[model samples]
Target: MNNYFNSNSVYIEEDFRCRFRMRRYVFERLLHDVQQVNPYFRQKLDRAGRPGFSPHQKVTVALRMMAYGSPADSMDETHGMSESTCLDTLQQFCDTIFQVHKDEYLRKPNQEDLNRLIRKAEDRGFPGMIGSLDCMHWDWKNCPNGWQGGFSGRSRKPTVVLEAVASYDTWIWHAFFGVLGSQNDITVLGRLPFFNNLMEGKAPQLHYYIKNRQYNMGYYLADDIYPKWATLVQAIPNPRNDTEKLFTLH
Candidate 1:
């Protein structure tokens, strides 16, 4: 393998950080953690007298794959690795990251988290709001042949639906993925863990006021497609006038 990550290369450290969305120190720390858990990331000389790619190069390629969502073949020249190896390395990298950090990073909000969210939402006019509920479709370029009809709806291309709840600061509180595009938002919601949490009485309590009226339940802002439940607040459809419409939209 050819190594492209040179310590004294002309590539500015700041430029590399900008491309990966993380500082050099942070990236190195992440690389260290991943390397500690997995030995494959460490460069080695194989029996055939061929050397593997360095850890820094492999990590940079994986990060670029995630940041750009580019095809595996496009990454070969960037780090001088084969296309198939690049894809395999990316898969392994993601799996290792999940194994190492899923508990702390992907966990549901705790009591302290809920309190902070409540305070943040209170400043934004919606007193008891914690986050927004939404669903987005991601195009599945390599969907298997047997699953074409099941995954493709109006898109004419296979897609996977992701239902997520996120706070205003872009922090995700909940996420459910791998749903077929044919399924509606309501169907996805029914299948996700959020509903399970609500049904199991694991949801946190919230207290706030609107126009002197008090509300104790926490709610999420949602689109009109969702139901009119006390826990969900949808945008007003067919506002009476421009002012009301502006308010509803904003």
Candidate 2:
């Protein structure tokens, strides 16, 4: 008990919270959630008959590593786990979180979800708009030799693109990660699974009214680089009028 609890506050877990960068309650809740789905997260006795680290500690170290983008060895002081073990813990934690929440969290919109999105978007004066589509890059520190040149054209750094469609509330409805950085945004969009889902008629139907004009389809807010399409809404370039400026501003 003394080992896990701080000497100053036995009940509050002040030291734990400080090290984990989360409230004690949230840490415990995350541990409970993961324990239900992953056996690897469960605490166990070692082969030497010594008690191993608890599930919360493993998750805390992994979350800290990911949240801070720090190396595994950085957690040795607080987590007391070996660098190799920290990497394994992080891998297991990510896989378990995805397996448990993928159905509800990462899945595409359903009818009810679509309705909620439509309501939220309409309330923001953009009726029938689902989300903003954009691409972000993540640096690849260990990119392969053959791929490095291709991925490092402009930035001179190897990166992988992640395209996502995210709403005002930050709910991501579409995600296509791991596209090569060599491809432009248009090529990335063309090769993404989001378009394949649309082509296969797997996307949910959308209906909304814009300026009292009824529409049967929804659209996404994209930047100028995206191609002209029925489902894409781009801002007017160099607006010289109040209406166009206001439209672009909002």
* Number of the top-ranking candidate, with TM-score as the measure: 2
Which candidate achieves the best lDDT against the true structure?
A: 1
Which portions of model 2 miss their true places by more than 4 Å? 1-29, 47-50, 197-204
For candidate 2, lDDT tens digit of each residue in 121-206?
Answer: 88988888878899888888988999887776467788887788998877786788755544457768878766765445433567
How does model 1 fare in lDDT?
Answer: 0.80
lDDT of each: 0.80, 0.79
Error of 2 at 234 (Å): 1.6
Worst 10 residues of 2 by lDDT: 1-10
The CA lDDT at 213 in model 2 is 80
Clashing pairs in 1: none
Q: Give the TM-score of candidate 2.
A: 0.81
Off by over 4 Å in 1: 1-29, 35-52, 71-74, 178-181, 196-203, 241-246
lDDT of 1 by residue, 7-117 (tens): 665567677677788777878887998899999789899899898788887888899889888778987776688899998889989999998888766988887888998
Quote the lDDT for 155 in model 1.
67
